[model samples]
Target: MRINLRGLNRTKKTLADGTVKIFWYAWKGGPPLSGQPGEPEFIASYNAAVARKVITPAGVLLSILQGFQASSDWDDLADRTRRDYVKLIKVIEKDFGDMPLSALADQRARGEFMEWRDKRAKSSRRQADYGWQVLARILSWAQGRGLIARNPCEKGGRLYRGTRADNVWTDDDEASFLARAPAHLHLPLLIGLWTGQRQGDILALTWMQYDGAHIRLRQSKTGRRVVIKVGAPLKAALDPVRQKEGQILLNSDGAAWTPDGFRSSWRKACAASGVVGVTFNDLRGTAVTRLALSGCEVPEIATITGHSMRDVNAILDAHYLHRDQRLGDSAITKLENRTKSPN
Candidate 1:
């Protein structure tokens, strides 16, 4: 029997003997304890319900998740986007892969899952919120196919609204960092500060990307094609230490650097320089600021950074670009000189 409970549409069963059994939202078993199917009671009720032929033998949650990944919608996503989504979805599977998909419609079950996920992440708002969103998308897909009664995450609130704003490295910061950095870090630092490309893009670069005058590659994050002119500082840094290995950034064994390896090295270097609250990614913003300070227009900055015009302007206005004492002095001198030599 289907009944409305606590303003929610719930499912239950009326036995042949006129006894009412509160079935779980999935209709596969008796109502779950606090909507937790991991408990033995939920499993026993499900088995009994199936044996009596009172509920259909629908497959577990894993089957639905696999089918969703095989759908045309999944294929339409960008490669990077699909990879990121699957990373989060895989974590969800580790916890609830064997459970019935119908349990997802129950408010208590959904709440428990979110609570467990956030707690495991140590209350990291970004990881918890993004992972929850991935879960919400999967459940929404199931609901659309009539598998679940409804999406439980529709009421989930925001946990993190963090921005990318960070401190850009000044010339003094760069000099201090380089003086203390190991030999392996110098090339990456020069690339970051001069080209303003992302860390991932810089690490992925190969000898084929360099054509004597310019570097050519497609950005992995945004998939935008970028061709940056090789500036003097970058060229100078590479001419002395350019590796023969395939990727531009390689470990001592001439192997391509993994993401974790690069991060560890970067952290150690940061500690060596005693810089705080700044990361290698901040170099991209510093490059934008350098361009803006040199009187480069918004579009020109976008060409170098692979960011759109809107993003370049926002970075200049919100984060990186700033007027130093030199700019202030320039403004004052130009006005004063103009007044004294008024033509």
Candidate 2:
């Protein structure tokens, strides 16, 4: 495609703050071979040939989308994250209109372009964060393609500092919620509570991982096999949920529920049981806490919870530390009694 430069001039428009506005005009459909500008003919702008012809911003984005879809880098990314990129491109197109990455970079000069992103209305903070991540990725990719010299997002002010929701569940809360959960969800609930396995892993559990006396399953997040002896309470919970089929946890339709579905059901169960602020992930924290309270060593709890020693201790500090106060108090009382009796 060739650009038409007739009647268009490349000029530096001074801003109110005396900063130069850098701009050059070229044909939208193609590069300009020859055309006389109406003004500022003395200024010479460099004409460069691109490896791939960029006709429009939307065209470049479509190329990037196709490129990512066919590339190995797109593999192994979480399905949701991958979808976010596609969704984000559509969002940018809708909000800012399709423009070349180079042109977009130029427009990003004063950071007002990003202000539009912040002004967008979102249903949740998570959606807002996803938008930020999408823009960040696009800018990073643009930089790597040499389409832009630097990512304006690399300046870091445009990104949102999202708050992390809580992931702490108590034993009583877990018990209450599980009691109210549907009969079919027993195994899924046990896996969530006992192993702290992610919803995906729990839904993926097979009978081979469950031995008569212990459970051995590889964690998806870390790719580490964790083995834990079946405690009586957990065994009881699992007994009713065990199946001879492919997956230990299957929805009513005999298919595994997605994480989103599991989270929705979990929230409902929590509400029914009158347990507030307990997410499915809190079960993992509860498992770690229960192990620490039972006097399991730090390393042992880490094996069961798939936690680093530091994280295990942090959980212990938060949930199990105060529970040990009674033990300390009992020891002090015994010491006082012995001194009084000897006197």
Candidate 3:
């Protein structure tokens, strides 16, 4: 029997482990309806939800959150970012949903929010910071609408201080990984190191984006179109496996890789190869490092990597250039040549 209920929102999400989980909500941004559809408890909950005069009371945190979700600001976020924010919003709703919106305006509310963040940081600092950021964004949006006198989440500093500045892969690490990893993983590794593109962008890359000499695509995050003159190494790796259509990078099954699936495989391959302390993301910075070492100027490197001029400079200065002995050696050689020149 097919069951249809008006005002019910059903969402299906696939877990990292490939399990399908179905969620039922009374309405968009409304309370979740418990139990499976067609069950007595589910029907009862649905009835009660619809009967209620108001799902969320005004001047409460939950109401503000719902408002924010409906706003143009929320709709403007990138698809992946919006999905991530939805998870954080659920956490915020569970923790502080019923609290009066007025409490957020109190100067002391910032301390309380920080305390909540501190408890979460004990388990995962990066996750805690992400949650704080999302909550702050929501409060800021609410403040703009004049629902709150102030945003208490402002200036809540990060708990995760980990840096990947020095985490670029070395030549030996690259060799070991390629030797151990499956053949399908090779192209992705090469593309990251060569093009300096993010994992997501590379995974989403299609055959159409590549010409014989150049690969062109607009970065999903920044919307910047980058036309990379395919490096010798990447081009060599790409040629034999080049397809007439579909995504460039695929898994062992010859299908496009999901973010989670690729991450899991990449981690196992790294562990098997004895590679540690670096990630696929570090390839971006490594590309910048390699470019600088090859005598490419900042603007030129930025053009290839799709990073802004300032970002390229910061990556070189704060992360790679100062620490690289080769750059230091080149600087000394330049000084010696200048000193030896005829006056």
Candidate 4:
């Protein structure tokens, strides 16, 4: 699976002018330039392109990836979504790059793919489900392009089921995490809990997105615009940080946090916190719990959380709203009081 194409890397060639051009052959006579060889960052970009390419096959999965890469539809996808697709595509390419598309015509191919997915990235069924979803998209796009007759991935089933299966952080879990979490991580923790936003959105937060009153942005995954009121907790957390310009959040270096950098920091915090099975994502659902406990209706929670009313109700019913015994007691009390006084 770990095929090396280092020899296929671009070689530097002297141009008609004194400058040099870096390029790889497309399997032909000359090292043809693929882009602006004059650009300063050409080598870095050229190497990236090389890493994304695959060799000749009986119509390899790489060819479909290549086609998708060149399609306008790829450009239309949100950047975060595109990154996710590319990441999963590379995983599939690593395994099945040499396999022919004709092999996929067999219906059993879909089941085999699911088998492979189930075994991958152990401990996270959600990630495996996501990979299958992306694979289906690529297959669908290929079908649209007439590259294949039917999408083999259409028969594949998801690996993860119930959305509420993830751990929702409790008050005790929050206290445990904050007690051990280093000071630098406090802002992100507060933001995650208070705004009920995803990790991607938390990392991407800018000062411009926050007025003194609320935080507003279009969510990357759902494309929903959410304007969350700056409650007391979030306000107190933000007030003390005097660097109140540009990006609202920053890494230890005071630069904006990259996704990997933030994850690494969060992992360290979680490990030190001693809260097993709890995740940063769980904090968002925890916020939903907090809202429900405060008597916010499902519609009110959806407006703030950017989830559907159905999803909000599901969360409240399954995870957040522990049905109070007092409510049942009150109902029984009302029934008894309304009885005909034994007359």
Candidate 5:
């Protein structure tokens, strides 16, 4: 009599002593099936392996989180977003991993989650809000999968109310940073200011994306492709080191930069230059401000920065442009010129 099992994996290994041993498992990467072929113990082990319980207790939050992580929704998140979410996920697991999944069904769980967020907010409100968002997303995913009766994170409002309206980098900051920072750091600064790109996109920029006159790239987070005419300053910076291959910006060692590595170097440079109260990210809004000050309309700015009309208008109306004194100066100058002109 012969026996056949579905999803049974068998392997034969030759020992150093010239003996051969056979191994059996329920499936690839699954639990081992003990005993010999056609034996009751072997069949029983195989069945148990096939019906292996969830790694984390099914009633716990950790179990649903683990399931969410294995789903296609997690796989579909942008790389940068996933990196940010992973940090929050770790915090959630540490604090609430053992909480009962059923507790989420009760409205009281929302208060508990908000209390946890409140504690985190005391240290950094922005981080607390980000963590709360990630928790909400995870709970929503679990609920959609029928792993939970309800998502307690629903309707959880943001805790951070800070704005970047006046956060644009100034010309003095740029000049000081350039004068103090290393030569290798200069081009990245120029690229961020002139192109209005995120640090991630700028760091990932390769020579192939540039053509002396223009730069072409697809934003990592939004997946929007943009073609920008090279500004005079950025062109001047890029011309001398133009390469047919590899990244446009490199470290002192002439190698590509990882995000963490670039951020660390940038922080050191910023501190050394006395350029305080402004960040590299502020350069994006600064670029928009510069374009507006130069008399470019919202649509023109959108075309260059890959911002939608609404985003460009929002940045101009509610953020950087409104706070910039240069725009006021430009408006007065234009009015003076208009009055001076003969009718």
Candidate 6:
């Protein structure tokens, strides 16, 4: 039986016996729904003329969200970068009212978002710049996928600049820091003062790194194995401090200190030692400076410090070539010895 509701008020089904089966409408004190008040009950219907599947507005919106799910490609980014990307969503929502991604991607809308970000209280300008850098990468990914025509942060420049720059530790400051470092930290401190390894690299030293008399390891950052002969001063500090702890250095709690924790404790030690304007990184610089001053060649210093020629040159210029009275006297002694007769 074929039923057509496009005709008179009541829809009819034509039966096999040539009889009409009328399906009457239930009115709510008026007329049939999608119809007018009772007349012939004929309602003009346009869809019956064609036969095509309908896509609702809700379905289109759902497909857009599905595309967003398809665009979830956060792999290969660094851990910190991935965290920053997650935070970008919150920044977007706070700056602009939550809307479909398409609607929010307008140039003016993005400009407004950046303006709102400038007014954010949680982050300073530099920090905000870092966040937006991550956002720019995400927008690039979106652009490649045809989600957006271009990156919104393409025009954003560096947010903050011109703060206090590099603060290298000085010679007198190094001597004072070493003299005041606690007995337990003495060897570790000397290693830091002699070898320009980062705190984490210094802390990573184990008994295995000591090959009978020398300390050596393939540095994590540079991937270069540097063998440093334990000199008298370093050995003297190491002798009494060496223990069955298996590792070279451990905190008061008998556990190894993380780089950040070591840096925090070292800062306190520096303050107590009365050394001002120095950073933990400056310790590495101090070690490199002292080595160059002690007549170690650039290659020799780089062997231990994991710095390249260019880096060593900077350290030498900033620290080594600046000669004092001690160096001048030594130079004069060498000259006199070379010209003088042995009587």
The candidate that wins on TM-score is 3
TM-score of 2: 0.62
RMSD to truth, every model: 14.5, 15.6, 5.3, 8.8, 10.9, 22.2
> Backbone clashes per model, in order?
0, 7, 0, 0, 0, 0
Q: Which 10-residue span in candidate 3 carries the lowest summed lDDT?
A: 11-20
lDDT (tens digit, per residue) of candidate 5 on 53-91? 344455888766655554556545555676687677778
What lDDT would each prediction earn against the true structure? 0.71, 0.58, 0.83, 0.72, 0.82, 0.59
lDDT of each residue in 126-243, candidate 3, tens digit only: 9999999999999988888788889999888889998776798899989998998888888889999999988878888888788879998877677678899998989999988888
What value does the lDDT take at residue 204 in candidate 5?
A: 81
* Candidate 5, poorest ten consecutive residues by summed lDDT: 11-20
- List the candidates' TM-scores in order: 0.66, 0.62, 0.84, 0.74, 0.79, 0.53
Put down candidate 1 lDDT per residue, 78-129, tens digits, no spaces.
Answer: 4446668877867876777777766766778867877866685676888888
Judged by whole-model lDDT over C-alpha atoms, candidate 5 comes out at 0.82
Task: Tell me which of candidates 4 and 6 scores higher on TM-score.
Answer: 4
- lDDT digits (tens) for residues 279-316 of candidate 2: 66666776776666577899998887678899888767
Best by lDDT: 3
Error of 3 at 315 (Å): 1.3
TM-score of 6: 0.53
Model 4: per-residue Cα lDDT over 1-343, one tens digit each? 3333344434453321123544443222212224454454544554565554533454777777666655655544655576677678778878886777887888888778878787883867888888888888888989987998878778666667755444777677778887888878888888988988888777777777787888888776676888899999889888777455677888778888877788888898889888778778888888887787677888888999899999888877776555444446767887898894665
TM-score-superior candidate, 2 or 6: 2
Residue pairs with clashing backbones, model 2: 1-30, 2-30, 2-31, 3-30, 3-31, 3-32, 57-99
